[model samples]
Target: MFSRFLVFLLFSCRSLAFEDTYVIGAGDTIQISVYGEKELSIDSLNINSSGKFEYPYLGELSALNKTPEQLKAEITQGLLGDYIISPKVRVSVVEFRNVYVNGEVKKPGGYEYQPGLTVDKAIALAGGFTDRASRSKVYIAQNGSDDNKNKVKLSEKVLPGDIIVIEQSFF
Candidate 1:
């Protein structure tokens, strides 16, 4: 049992790193840094509803569905030559999109997403399950996808912008 628990713990930690490969989307805030160029750096830059943000020179660059490194590359390429001979661009996600919890949760609403967020933790943030909440009927609908709602367990990791629904228990 101890070994099983240890494996589970390691798996959970490893799964949490999925955010590193997370696709940038609307409602996510990102930070862009250019080495030794304070004026070119931006902090807490929120991606607008259109999934685009205005950079210093690369006006209105799109960020939707792009990884941080991809955006960094775009910035670096854009700033090279005319803007800067050697642009050291760095892009990092400062804030992930909110995870929404609704249905049978006590305080159903959207909550800020954390790196290691799981179904259980997300429910806790929404004030936990109510009396009518059905633990077995929990479902998740990933943000920005056409996939149908999928059943999820308490231990399942919740990604940023995921919508969690706790169905009512008839019992």
Candidate 2:
């Protein structure tokens, strides 16, 4: 039993290692830094509706479909190739847009996506399960994708826009 429990724990930790990299999206605020160039540390970069951002030196750059790291690399490459030499860039996400969590939770609303957040944690953040909430029957609707609407059971990690539904327990 001890060995089985240990195996389960290891598997759980490994499965939680999904990439949480921020993909530049509209309404997302990002912080971009250029190593050794204090003047280049720009904050509050909002991706436009066309998924682009404008910097004074870098001009307009695409932010959509690019991770924070990827965006940094692209900026560094662009700057180094055309203007600066050997640029070092770092990108960080200062704000997440939002994620919705509703149904059966005590407070049921939206919450920001933080590191190491699980289904149980999100539910707890919404004031926890109500007396009529069936914890065991918790369901997650990921991205509202109908093709991927299959239910997930015994899973902890829930993604953004995942609607957690707690069924009413029949007595």
Candidate 3:
């Protein structure tokens, strides 16, 4: 039916925009659960500054740039022999990393990153822009890299670890 086709189209478009596979990064908090093993489940584990985490049976595991599903697979594989038989492992991000907002914002600092966050929302979290802030001079440095800095608008989507700078306006 036309209605069914329209519903499918809508869902497909939504999925395209959704970040289904989020990469793990430093400062992110993760939770790992094994279906039947209480001791092996990690309620909450923060990825260290080096983007690595120590697991009981897995020893040191690098989580940087790996998706939660990928990490789950690694853990499941590591525990298959000695730790658990057929472990139904689940890994999820408990908290995302923070994004920094600096310059002309009143309360400029790092704020927790969330999905669908934009420059406008980040500025709001930083107590909005100062009176002298330049609305047209917003810039973003991805992952704190100045080399990647570029001019952006208020509607620009903010990524984790990004640095947003609001220049001072004079005129």
Reference-based TM-score of each model? 0.85, 0.75, 0.85
Candidate lDDT (C-alpha), each: 0.89, 0.71, 0.89
What alpha-carbon RMSD in Å does predicted model 3 have with respect to the real structure? 3.5
Q: Where is model 1 more than 4 Å wrong at Cα?
A: 1-19, 144-147
The TM-score of predicted model 1 comes to: 0.85
Clashing pairs in 1: none
Candidate 2 lDDT, tens digit per residue, 1-171? Answer: 999999999877764443235465655678898888878778667665588767658788888767887888888877886667788888877765555667777888888876566888888788888888776787777754535654456357776556677777776
lDDT of 2 at 117: 69
Could you tell me how far off, in angstroms, the CA of residue 85 lies in candidate 2 after the best superposition? 1.2
Residue pairs with colliding backbones in model 3 are none
Off by over 4 Å in 3: 1-19
Please, what are the lDDT tens digits per residue for candidate 3 over residues 138-157? 99999889999999999999
